[model samples]
Target: MDDIGEYIAKESIRYAELIVSKLFSAADILETYPRRGTIVPQFMDESIRQLMVDNYRIVYQLAAGDKVNILTVHHGKRLISNTRHFKKKK
Candidate 1:
């Protein structure tokens, strides 16, 4: 198995922090390593994964070569709506 790594965007970290309120320690996030896209896509490399932590949907993507990247974290209902802006940037 490849060694998976984490790459959290600054904004995503901020958003996650706000919702989870430091409840997710560095170790917690690290423990989620090798996280795959269970909902939106299969495996982290194919697409982003939205993990539910209470009312929040933690959006993240995994890159090739075993790397986990966090996109954003928001309320589940607003996830799809809020992600529209990111598309425009691409």
Candidate 2:
């Protein structure tokens, strides 16, 4: 029982670290290769695209002056109800 508890704790910490690292890497990729992600067909917008990092989706858009505007970052399991307005982030 003790060994099982220790393993669970370690796994939890590792998973958390993985998520943080993945998020950082995704941000870096977006900065370096803004148009690397494919367009999200559901929206039917060429400027909008999504990059999948693990189970999360990094949604962004090509703003004026060829700048990549990060819209939102959320888990894939959740539904994106309103894609119209998202708080812009650099």
What is the C-alpha local distance difference test score of candidate 2?
Answer: 0.71
Q: In candidate 1, which residue pairs get closer than 3 Å at backbone N, Cα or C atoms, i.e. clash?
A: none
Considering every candidate listed, which one attains the maximal TM-score?
Answer: 2
Residue 82, candidate 1: C-alpha displacement in angstroms: 8.3
Candidate 2, 1-90: lDDT as tens digits: 233234445769666666767766887887777888888666767888888878777778888776787777777777766545642335
User: What tens digits encode model 1's per-residue C-alpha lDDT throughout 8-57?
Assistant: 23347555445455324421563456463354542322455666665556
- Candidate 2 versus truth, CA RMSD in Å, comes to 7.3
TM-score of 2: 0.72
- Inter-residue clash pairs, candidate 2: none
Deviation of model 2 at 64, angstroms:
2.4
Give all TM-scores, in the order shown: 0.49, 0.72
